[model samples]
Every structure is written in structure tokens, then in C-alpha cells.
Target: MNQYIDIVLRSVTIYFFILIALRIFGKKELSQLNTADVILILLISNSVQNAMVGANTSLISGIIAAFALFCINYIFKKVMLKSSFIKKLVQDKPEILIHNGITYYKTLARLGITSDELEEAIREHGLEHYNEVKLAMFEIDGNISIISGNEYLKQTHFKKKIIHKNLAGKK
Candidate 1:
């Protein structure tokens, strides 16, 4: 019984710890998982597995810990949905990268996004140049969405691979 309580406590602590860590790391980290990010996630899971299970290696103990994690996650999500304050704390607001063909350099620099990356996102959206983009946003999900002022150049919301050479030539 005592060991089970310890497992639950450890699991809960680790869960909150990770949640806070992710929040502190910013939303960009969640947008795309690079090679290092994948390895880090794997290593974190492996390291915390033992901490959650402890010495009890029993199936029941493992199940209990897993159940606790799921329950906590579900409850957290529900609370976040209902409470704007909690939601704001747990998630990032969308960032405007460009508006009316003017780039927000300060916002981009603060978000650690380079001009090159922004240009790449613009190109990926099939826009020939930044001037063609009326609005560009770094969404909370880590995707850059572009809205073109040119009606003819507008495209559906999707992540398309940027082709270096089109009929018009390289952008």
C-alpha cells in the first residue's frame, strides 16, 4: 500500500514537472520535433519510467501509475478548456509575423524565428515573395500560416513542399 502511494505521488510530481517544463520551453518546441527532440523525448520517458514505477516492478503498480497519469491528463485538459486563465498559461497565443505586407521583425526575433525561416514558410505556402503575403502568423501549433492579398494566389490551408523552381523561375 505504501509503495503504491509513493508511485502515485512520484507519477503526479513527474507529470506536473514535465508540463511546466514544456510550458517554459515555449510553443515552438512543440511545433516540430527534430532529431534531437525525438531522442530527448525517448530518453525522458525512459528515465522517468523507473521513477514512476520504483522498486515494485509489479504489473498492478505499473497499471495504477499509468491510470493516474491518464486521469490527470484528462482532468487537466478539461480544466484548461473551461478556464481561460489556465488555458492561457498552458498554451501559447498565436503570433503575428506579418500584416499588410509589413513584417514584425521584433516579434519574429523575440520568438527566435529567423527571416529565412519566415521566407521558407512563405515559399512553402506557394507565395512568390513576402510582399505577396498580406498576413502571416505563427500559429500556436508551430505552423506558419500565410494569407495572400492577391485573390488569385490564395491557396488552401496546407503545408506544401516548397519547389525551388516553378514555371516563373526560382523565388
Candidate 2:
């Protein structure tokens, strides 16, 4: 096989391997990257680079590997759009966490969500308790979306905020 073809084949193989690994691990890993998550991502990229290009570390080999990855990704997305089973395999279905103030404890446990995490998501949406929630869903993107029953409170999308407190007292 040509060296360029070899590079392309290796890159595509690694791409599918990572995709399958992500599917088995769950979609929650896709959201909310912490310091550790960032580190893991950097390490994963570095680890896979050699595997994709093998001993050929030339510029052309690198470009070929990248092109192969992008083409495979585009093809995968198109196939998923036309095939429900492929789409379901790659993405998790949204789950209902709460409805009419009734919390789904079983669903929470199955999704590995703790009570504290649920309460934090509720409080982030300005709700005092689970009883105030009309509906709460564990979205496919790994976010807990809350809909409150209060008429006065305007409906709004919840976005997670990361606060970096300044150590210096000076404002």
C-alpha cells in the first residue's frame, strides 16, 4: 500500500475507535470540561497523533491524516442523518428527570446523577425546590434543563457559568 494511503487508513481506524469508545462511555463526558478534562483531551490528542501518522511525521503525512479524519467525520454525520439506528448509537436520547413536580429518582440513579447535582441545576434556574419544577430534562448534550411552573418567572435557557475568583483584593 502507498504510504499516503496507509496514513489515511490508520487515521480513519482511530477515528472510529474513538467514536465507539465515546458511545460506550456515555455522552455526559462531552460536557463541562474541568482542568482534568482539559489535560485528558491534550494527552489523548498527543497519544493518537503518532498512531495516525505512524513513522511518517512529514507535513504531507500530517495533512493527509487530518484530511482523512475530516472526511470520515463528514461521512459519519451524513449517514447518521439518514439512519435512525446509527444516530441513536452515536447520540443519547434526552431523558425526563422531572414532570409536574415529580422527580424521577430511578432515572437519576441510572444516569449517575446525584441529588446535590440535581439541586444545583434547579437552583441555577432560580427555583427553590424540585416541587416548583414543571419539567426537568437531561438533555442529549448532558445538560439538565429545568422548566418551572411559576407563572411570573419568565422562561429562559440555563447556561453553566464558571467563576474564576481573583485572589487579589484590589477590584
Write the residue-wise lDDT of candidate 2 on 43-67 in tens digits.
9989999999999999999999999
Summarize candidate 1's per-residue lDDT along 95-151 as a digit string, tens digits.
999998899999999988989889888887788788888999998888889999988
Question: Please, what is the TM-score per model?
Answer: 0.85, 0.87
The C-alpha stretches of model 2 lying farther than 4 A from their native spots are: 155-171
Report clashes for each candidate as comma-separated counts. Answer: 0, 0
